[model samples]
Target: MFALRRLSTVALSGARCKHSLPDLPYAYEALEPIISRDIMTLHHQKHHATYVNNLNATEEKLSQAISKCDVSTAISLEPALRFNGGGHLNHTIFWETLSPKCTEASKDLMVAITESFGSFDAMKELLSAAAVGVQGSGWAWLGYDPKIKRLRIAQCANQDPLEATTGLKPLFGIDVWEHAYYLQYKNVRADYVKAIFEVTNWEAVSKRYSKAAC
Candidate 1:
């Protein structure tokens, strides 16, 4: 398992890195049945791309504010920074969270799950419930509390990034935004949330967990 460098980059360096929409690791139709080609296409090309573009624009404005030593303007740009930056961060993790390959959790991850929520199945149910209960557009996350060295389940409203908002290193995330599932699942958000695990990239998730534990 490797470190979650991509998410680290997303969380820490996006504004400085000249953000761009990452290419899908697999074909759009690869996650078929769980997510249709049309949904994936629109989600990545349109939605994720918009976040990237907006993040760049936000950072440019922020840089100008900083150059002028304009504290108020820089502070005002904080909302835009967090919104567009969090949107970019969240979607970056979301893309890597799903895959055509159905990899099983590593032994380390399973142990952590057992310790945190009794069992892998139980953890899934808990996370799914969190995803379903999101009042509106949001995200459900399996995160690691580095300070306490424990696993935790958390949900965030809108595009709020997990680490920035809660100090939890996000190991896995489920995006419950309407655009994420509306086209294929319609208003059945719960069904879409439950079905995402079918294409879950556990190897990637395990890698993130391993890194977070360190």
Candidate 2:
């Protein structure tokens, strides 16, 4: 499986400090009707910013614990590390996977999808289904299984990072958190999940797939 590097920079105060929120690639309203400006604004500035903040804080504490040679304390921080770290990682991919502009699936990516799922439409349907099927706050992902050399649709509960939990390199992800679509789609998460395809940045996903396939 491809190694999913930690994107967040860790710098403790007594140790070192540089983790910051990543700027959105486009304006808040770029996705237009597919995703509302209010949704984008809150999702990125508030929700995602919270994750970054929490991750930095968690890392800071972990660093302190490590410095004291407190293995027990460091071990106790696993939940925070997994949750906040996964949140940050998932959001990073989510933001990049979506675009205001429509993007075509690359030939290689399309071939993989078709081979694995019968057709592009079939794969899209399955991915959408997976997203809509999430029980709670979770994600649906198009991930590459390096072992079988297959493209797969997987669902993850809570903020579990795709690669970390499943060892599948994530190509694209659809967040099912209420914070992601509650404003626009309301309780109709399926609609939101289906509509997300319109704004999907397939070019970005294709590039991720290319790397994962390698």
Q: Please identify model 1 stretches exceeding 4 Å from their true place.
A: 1-15
**Model 2: per-residue Cα lDDT over 1-214, one tens digit each:** 1222222222335345647889999999999999999999999999888989999988888877766668999999999989989999999999999999879999999999999999999999999999999998999999999999999999999999999999999999999999999988899998998899999999999999999898
Expressed as tens digits, the lDDT of each residue in 1-214 for candidate 1 is 1256455444454456688899988999999989999999999999899988988988877776665557899899888888889999998888887899778889999999999999999999999999999998899999999998889999999999999999999999999999999999999998998899999999999999998897
Those runs of model 2 whose alpha carbons end farther than 4 Å from true positions after fitting are 1-17
Measured by TM-score, how close is model 1 to the native structure? 0.92
The models' CA-based lDDT, in order, is 0.89, 0.90
Q: What clash pairs does model 2 have?
A: 11-16, 11-17, 12-16
Error of 2 at 127 (Å): 0.7
How many clashes show up per model? 0, 3
- Relative to the true structure, candidate 2 reaches a TM of 0.92
